[model samples]
Target chain A: MISVLNAGNWAEQYSTIGERAFLSITMTVVGIVIVVFVLTLLTVVVSLMSRLINGKPGGKETTAPKRQPEAAAEKAAVEPAGSSAEPGASASERASETDGALIAVITAAVSLALSDSSQPSAGFKIRRIRRV
Target chain B: MNSIVDFFNAFSETINRLWQGSGFTNIQLSQIGMILIAFVLLYLAIVKKFEPLLLLPIAFGMILTNMPMAGIINMNFYDPDFITSLGYPENTIFAYREVLNEGGLLDYIYLGIKLGIYPPLIFLGIGALTDFGPLLANPRSLLLGAAAQIGIFVAFIGALLLGFTPWEAASIGIIGGADGPTAIFVTKTLAPHLLGAVAVAAYAYMALVPVIQPPIMRALTTKKERGVVMEQLRPVSSTEKIIFPIAVTILVALIIPDALTLVGMLMLGNLLRESKVCERLVKTAGNELLNIVTIFLGVSVGATATASSFLTSRTLLIIGLGVIAFGFGTAAGVLLGKLMYRLSGGKVNPLIGSAGVSAVPMAARVSQKVGSDENPSNFLLMHAMGPNVAGVIGSAVAAGILLALLR
Candidate 1:
């Protein structure tokens, strides 16, 4: 084990070199082990924390209420006058509301154009559009 | 005619006095060489944009310190004999009184580094900016961070073989951590004499991460492994993020109290950022406070590299060892990544392993670049961030262990 640890014969080169080489090898092995151990412990701790906080293991979807796409589309159709100055509404909420209304308007225009062309617009569904 | 002659004599005398005290006459070849090195650093910072924020100030400080008899810095503070003659024991806390009484502007600036206040404050800024979500999502990435630290010990042995004292070797070894603040913090405590060389080497190598990591990363991992795609990270809750820093601080403090100053300040900064109530403080810590400390830290650290201390063969060896340490660290992280890849049934991309050297976003970007080369659609940036941030914590832990053993 000693020879393996000092494989490069670093200890043999100098009298003072032996102690430091030994210490370095020991520290290296021990340091790597400790880091791994601590981090592993942290991993387990964090996993537990997430599980406890979210009430489920990793990757479980949250149970918070979300507005469905259909509901959003209906709201957009009914509220053609557009968003009002709602209290405590975030910028993202306002933007998303505006986006739903714009999408509804565009879909209506596309549908009207297709009906006027007198061609069947089968399997034509607008899923989403994102800026590049 | 006599009055005119007297005026001429006085003029000549004044010119002679100016020449005697001027940098032109007092400068040596060594000082000139240091000044030229400083200019090169300035060019690298300005033109190439190599870690410009810190390097620019450092290069400027080097220029200020090397000018002969400028009285910008007191080199005597670094002199051991001089420190002892001032009625204090060797290696005691820095005598700020000595610097306050006899030193100049640079000396006052250097006190931040000498008193070991700058690195932790820098860590505070880093903590505010850092996102631990990726790391939290994939806890196993922490092991890769640990594996990356093999380079530090590899260099420690190399330095020992090359005849650096244990303390000096520890300081040199930390350059492998690829963390400028950690390297500066450890070197300041262990070997202040080598602080200038170590700091420059750490930051320079960090800037060269894109150049240094790719070859080693490619050499260590197979193409198939690099092409592997990782699953997207799960969203982390704000509560988890807030608890993380506190838990880590408490654990590290209990385990290694010596690391408390660096680790504690880092966690505190992170806590402030994660808590969501201290936006003003977080903004200040992350921007204004950080900028101020970085300027003082860089210039003062650069000023320490006077001609007498910097122009030596040892500096060359340190620079060489620093590269070796960084390369070895990259290799080790990749190799461990490969191991984990096999263990996890190819879920992990080995390319992200190279990000374990604590160069933060740079190492992570290199991982992304390498992965994209193999497959253009492969987005490893967010995935690689897990190990990259973990490497920061790992290096701090390693530094604490070294300080505990060696100090």
Candidate 2:
């Protein structure tokens, strides 16, 4: 058996098949375990930092809590000005009403601007308002 | 008449010398085979577009070095007479002067690689291009990146079992990191002799990430796990982005100073990009500077692959071990992802775990592809990017550990 404590020429010391195989296996296990430990430490650090800053643990639901208020405000704005419908009207109906009103206002504005310019406003229609 | 005869004799002698100088007469079967290998690399780079930026220059350099009497690289640094005549001790760390006196342009350019300048600079560029937002948003992915490094150690042991010396095995093992620059950097420092085969194996396997990773990812993960939709990452403040590199650098320097060269440069580049004040420097590092270093790094590394050095049983073993290491790394990562998947109550997609191999966007893309195949709405790209970028840091740290222990 080769002395593991020997600091001799590694090639010479670990020349035998048994020595080579044993050292390789030992090193492989040690290397992997160390890597995993280091990374796990990093994981804990990163997870802690993220939690501290974001005030949450993991995944997408964390963002939802932060965005809920903004979404509520948007929902209120998109609601009809004076509908007698219940507070829990289907979301799609409310969305359509908001869209129709938005389109009417946009069309009126465009028609007025085009009428002033004397360009043909007769055939014009706003099909979409892309947010580019 | 005597003058004419004298001129004819001189002309004949000149013609004979030129014939001898021609590469055709000096070319042997091995060198011819190397040239063919060079051509194949060129075809892969140009036609297949497999990491063309690096492979193209590498292939061209191979051709340049193989030509007879080009003297682009001197492989005779080990010759006892050559070492003795140069008045240097035998087996000096590197025969720099021998290369300067007898070597050609490529040999001079090769100094960047030998002295360890180019890889860090390339890392700087990589840092500039990388977005750590994904990593920062999901820090747990760091574990996946760490898990991927299992490939390196596995390969290291495999190389040892195959009769490679400790240093050589360590260098070969680093190929499992799936990081070209890190692999090159470690190989050059640990086993300069194995640089060519190791570098080729590293980059070629890196290019094959798309081919190599999917099967392993599938075998290790289930359809349901692949379809797991990770939540959108929380927004990271600009301050966190700026602090990340500084904190990482400080931590790495304190922990493993040997890795400071690679880790420091990578963090510096990241800091430049995140700071937003150094836009000019960031642009240069990411674009012009990176391009210049890559050309030199590729060609010089390729020039080292002469027929005698590259065509060896050890090279073959390194190549085989490299694949195994990569496979093992992918498996390890996915397995870890499975653990996370189970622990997270099916919230984490195991496919993103495969991104731990640090092949960057390539590994991340594989995760996205596999996930999308399972469920079209499942966008694992951003989640995968988290682990993918972490793998870079993980591999750099691993390289440092190996250097500290082995060197």
Candidate that scores best on TM-score: 2
lDDT (Cα, 0-100) at B35 in candidate 2: 91
Q: Which candidate wins on DockQ?
A: 2
Per-residue lDDT tens digits for candidate 2, residues B45-138, read 9999988888888888888888887777775653346667778886565576777677678768888987899999999999999999888878
Per residue, candidate 1 scores C-alpha lDDT tens digits across A19-123 of: 666777877787777777777777777778888897766433222123345555566667643374333334777877787887788888888898888688745
Instruction: Give candidate 1 regions above 4 Å deviation.
Output: A1-16, A58-132
Clashing pairs in 1: none
Q: Residue B85 of model 2: what lDDT?
A: 76
TM-score of each: 0.84, 0.87
What TM-score does the A-chain of candidate 1 achieve? 0.33
